[model samples]
Target chain A: MAEHAPSAKRIQSETDALIAPGHTLASITEKIASLALKRRTPLGWFVGFGISFLLLQALLYTLAVLLFKGVGVWGINVPVGWGFDIINLVWWIGIGHAGTLISAILLLLRQDWRTSINRFAEAMTLFAVACAVIFPVFHTGRPWLAAYWLFPYPNTMGLWPNFRSPLIWDVFAISTYGTVSALFWYVGLIPDMATLRDRAKSKAWKIVYGMAAMGWRGSARHWHNYESAYLLLAGLATPLVISVHTVVSLDFAAGVIPGWHATIFPPYFVAGAIYAGFAMVLTLSIPLRKAYGLEDFITMKHLENMAKVMLATGLIVAYGYTMEAFMAWYSGNPYEKFMMANRMGGPYAVFYWLLILCNVLAPNLLWIKNLRTNTTFLFLISLVVGVGMWLERFVIIPVSLHRDFLPSSWGSYAGTRYDWSAFLGTIGLFLTLFFLFIRFMPVISIFEMRTILPEGEGGEPKS
Target chain B: MRRRGTGTPDIHGVMAEFNTPHDVVEAAHRVHAQGYRKVDAYSPYPIEELSHALGFHHSPLPLLVLLGGIFGLVAVYGLQYWSAVIEYPMNIGGRPLHSWPAFVVPTFDGTILFASLTAVLGVLALNGLPEPYHPVFNVPTFALASRDKFFLCIEARDPKFDRDKTRDLLRALPGVVDVVEVEH
Candidate 1:
């Protein structure tokens, strides 16, 4: 609340509003819910959605080709046996971390600014996780069996998944992460769903939202239970956000490769995940808050806080890179030294420098408070960070794998046409899902917004 | 919970609207003090301390999750041991069959999985949710409970069931907008 504290007379004079000026709780529901119910589709939404849909179709096409031609359609042959598929899997999974950080971690830390963005961010987490799992399953070449084989169910074949393998651990980590994130997201949506149910204009939408709300009556008893459950979920989810990416990094580090075998990976991966995740959040929120005219809810204060997080996490990621280089030299091992030298000056040198530029240099702009507060600058910088994070994965995976212990075994690799399609297509799929989410659900948690209003104003912002 | 008879106009309670969450908390305290046992307060968001004032002071969620997490830790760790060590074993790098060190990651994951699921199910079951309908929704303006308003519903089943006295009690509260009959 931005309200000036009252004197003994208790005049209810307003200070600056936290949400858009003059929008009461009633109008908040009307404004957000109407976008769905009224179905006044914006041209920008169509243009964005159309492109994403096309990319999604392209992804599907590539999948069909992959299924038909087998893993041969990709560039992972012999030495470079983990190409764009693994890169994408790591990328999407890393992207999912930001949502959990916002919704669960920030909630535990009592950061209320997250209320404006947490709902959609959790939705982003779910979608990104959804995009992520597609790669590993399809990469297995037989997804149907890989799906069941990945789990440890008793079978007539008399086999179980290798529990020692990080790949198997990844199956557990990602699936559990997905389940918890989904439940957390849905639990938070209940009261707001009830709000939508009540405010719905049409009978169909009312019933749809009614079922989604699960008869939430806003009772003190219900909120008490709901709040407790939410807090518990947050506590439970906090560890998963760190653990999922740590386990992902283990997939690389557990291997015998010199560059991959490092003690710094777990925390390093976690830091990089947060760095990329915050960047993506900024990328989505800057445009979203502006277009929806939710400038007050997703205030400049909120934007600046996110930039600060990105800066801090980005620096940690940069430190991880430095340590990785230092450790390679400090070890005094030829293979390790070669791996470090290769990363710096090998054929992938262009990508390595680009990664530095995007991940390290671009986020440096946020050090100046003005650049971070500038929406266009933040958007572009965030995009650079997103690309930088991708390149970081590329350098870690394909570049490292392209040449290994034996000179005879060394072979350079490039992603085929199908590989690019799969990667880009998932991006499209992510955006498409995001568009539907923004159009249908309350992107900002409506009920939570009420709590932020100043006292005695009756949930109404003054004009 | 105790539905008095059937059909519409079957009076559930006298529902009153409060201007802000604070006023609702104050009215709830006053009503609870007035020996109204079958009272419930509704707000657009959780009002801190309001639940305790309205006599919903305890929740079993944390305990349920704790127990669930312990059970999950043991169950998942044991399952991995049995699968890798006892049921079928392979000599990959000639490591130990139990591989208890390798079990930690999945065990941590399983604990989270079970704990979170328990929280969701426990909440739903305790709240008696997936309830397609509620009597509160029958109160037409009760929709405002999800928006700007806070409501205090005094069920007719309470011993002090004088409709006029209850209405007067609510109307006397500061910042109360209206008191209306809520029927199922």
Candidate 2:
């Protein structure tokens, strides 16, 4: 035991309290669990939740109206068939990608820095995916049938979904991604729920947490199985993080539409997803860490690292934009060339430039190390980047669709009040779900955090 | 409301509380070396080397996920092949019935769908999990295992089972606070 003391000291200095220094494993458990157990919902949470709820209500109303009338309520016209619904769908799905990359990919790489934020990122993935799925469903104007129609089930009417269609691929891809993300999140939550169970004083808390914990006693044998399963899930999720988005990109690339027919959509879309995902992480995290007084847990280094990821992925997205333009010019295809011109100085030119500013120029600021480390700057930049990525989807979808090969069919489009409400409503949906999640569950991984403590690793205590 | 009982006071194991993670890990190693096979150590968090000392290596989860993915690929591709070519042939955009390139996306999706299911279900089945009732919860101080305490439980089912001898062995371990019998 004494011999391992040396190694214990080394581990302490190496992993240093990801939470506050001088905090024990007991303290970490207490602080995190108390946030839920004590029922001390902060004022910020109340304000945030209220705003989210109101917006969500507005969205639901808009959806109800859309269902009552038809797709005509949205600004979906002859040429620009896809509008805010499709654009918003792609945007939210892209936002969901970062969480998977952080939770699964970073775990496989053995990056311990991810431990602090991975839990929430996974929660973000599920919520964002939930928001993303709402679009394609209701966009059909007959969601009940669209949902059942997508599945290849036995029916009296011998009709089948077109196997070659990318939309069908999307149904499987998004649903699979959603289910896997949820399972992964819940599996990780079990041990942490046990912590909450044990510390809970009230009978109601005990029953709730205990059931969620599922008698997780942290037995070494259970841990062995848990670790192995977690790793397997991570390996399983890595490809999904790429493939789901690739299949999504295929939705556009598979299209015969001139601007969307490019081969680069897959990699470009994947990279853009990561870029936007990281920004969303930062956008949510910056305000959150401040509000929750979780600076010690989330840390400045985490923010900087996330910013660096945004910068790297942002550049890939920029390259994607550049190639889309160059290919349009190089191919000498009039429709493709016109698509580029339409994006640059056409009806939606303001959105295109804003996209360039937010996605391209905003990330360039991360080159300055100071800016990356600055939470305020990182937060604003991330928000800008998030906006830019959404606009990027808008530019790609409507601009291309508004003007096809035939000049007679060419027409610009705008989403109606319903479109804006639905889009705004999802923000409410995403935030509402997130706020509730933070209030109930351990926002950070209580069990995983202990590994960073000196005592768990047999490292010498630094202090 | 009171918790449910198993109706028999059958003793499950002898559990010893260890003050430090290092202490219990050392105890685990000694117990394993002394030829006690049904041994388990519980701690507030995962201790990497502790499980190795108890002789647990390799889970069959990866193999399960792989098999699931393989089956999914076959099933999905085959379903499409049969549906379009054999059952209900309908031509759209002049494409062939067995369009393998287009089928790749859905097949890829099916692989993920099945593989993820296998990962979750295989993990639960392998772990004997979602089990809210276990004898370990019978220990009075066992709740501490999720907080700051470390514990080692030696089951009565172990090959070398002797109540007095095991209690004596746990007591002799360094930094052990207490030892108590657990009932199922």
Candidate 3:
């Protein structure tokens, strides 16, 4: 059977090709497994885990104190009822948007490069949404009965959650963002789970993977259904991601507070999401590429492409800043002009400057290819951008609302220890989740990788 | 012209393997014309034309999920309205009854939650999940399914299944093998 012999030989060659040279899946699996197992130890993951645990503990203590002591434990006063809590809520919600932008929007665009980062990004979206939902739901004076917001009673107590309230809008935006993101992430994981299922050496691993794969047989019929479902989900998620961020902006836009009532908020917020998202991607990807040695998969080309997007969005955000300034002056609204003037020339001007430095100035370094390719430089810049974006949200929310329509109601705002610690706690939670995700999955879609084979069939660019 | 390997009298069906999905669909048409009504084909990738040859019907999953999501939205909105404005109207900012804009966020979230839940649940229920074990695992080389191997099972569960006739029919085709019954 010459035919049989050649086919047999071909099969062997194919197997060899898959696991050969620097591309051995076994070696990759071993490296990841070793990292994961080590990371489980108190010593290995101590820095991340301990930090997260401590932050969470501090947050719990602070929240308990706040709940027990009432909302007065913080600096929020008459006019600025929505202070650091809402600021942090919007900030976290904004952070959550980036993940879906990478996972859903990039997937729809057919950008294969998104595979390396989408899983972690999607997870980030979920965690960020978790962090977001916390502030709004619990920041209320009576978190114990936050359920009262949802009930439609006919009583004369007059305690109905204002349907016109942007706070109500946020509840919808953040929750929908979280739910849809979770679905998209899980569906994306199924094929990968099947891969793990087929490759596992241990019986326990096999069973775990098998259950997660949901009996994926790699049937043609199943693939058809899977692809269709994915396309449909992508269609839903892309617009949903955009809508979520736009609605988050509306929280400020809907208000009559001088700096908050801007018509340019929707686009501005979206641009900021992409900017912050790309910044975070750079932050994570730089470290990840070096640690996991994924230079080939998450190449400089991908980084550069993302950097260009960052530069564009950064400029747009700068424009939005300029527009807000111009609109204040042009509209001839005395209060609006005074609010914009105060933001630039008043007590919290340091935050405004930091936002400018981090968001506008930091990303300008991307123009230099040497800086873009230098992982260390990219990491530093990313950290700056990330910090800047958070500050941007802080300045937008607290400063704007701290003194709104009437200077009579104006008050100098300051975040308490609880505010600072809760924010730090969220950072810990985000890092812990990110680290765990990188350890388990390939961090890159293995199937999607195959499609990118430079010399393989169907390798040509799609028209 | 039946084979005796399966040790059964009535079983007969042809099996064939093709390198590309295009070849597989072309072969399916030929097999169907040769009166092999019981024949089936499989490939590593989906071949659209083959579905037509196999006469597959429409799936109701999308419609089911959409309807489930709509029901969830109605239920969530109705309950929220009942509780906030109807049962306990605690006025804070002097907002009126039937405050629909404020209801928009929770209603939207509930609708999405319902839709997503339905999609996930529908997929799992339709697929009959928690399938910890399967006979395919017993076929030592079946792991190749994840890679390049293509396979089809004309199960004994099928009405036309016959061991001998299936083997004879399979022999007439190229690269066919075993013709074994998939015992559950």
* Model 1 docking tier (incorrect/acceptable/medium/high): medium
What TM value does chain A in model 1 reach? 0.94
lDDT of 2 by residue, A1-463 (tens): 9889998996555334355567677777787777777766678789989999999998899988988999899999888888999999999999999999999999999988899899999999999999999999988889887754688876778877788888999998999899999999999998999999988988999999999987788988888878888888888889988998999898899899988999999999999999999999999888878877788788777887898899999999999999999999999998888889989999889999999998888799899987887888998898899899999999999988988788888887988888999999999999999999989899989888777766544331232
What value does the lDDT take at residue B115 in candidate 1? 90
What is candidate 1's fraction of native contacts? Answer: 0.85
Error of 2 at B170 (Å): 0.5
Displacement of residue B70 (Cα, Å) in model 2 is: 2.1
Please list all clashing residue pairs in model 1, or write none if there are none: none
Q: Which of the CAPRI classes, incorrect, acceptable, medium or high, describes model 2?
A: medium
Error of 1 at A457 (Å): 2.8
Model 3's chain A TM-score stands at: 0.87
Pairs of residues clashing in candidate 2 = A8-A458, A8-A459, A8-A460, A9-A459, A9-A460
Candidate 1 chain A, which ten residues in sequence have the lowest lDDT sum?
A8-17
- Per-model B-chain TM-score: 0.90, 0.91, 0.74
- Fraction of the reference Cα-Cα interface contacts (below 8 Å) that each candidate reproduces: 0.85, 0.75, 0.37
Question: Model 1, A20-53: lDDT tens per residue?
Answer: 5565666766676675666578899999999999
At residue B8, candidate 2 shows an lDDT of: 17
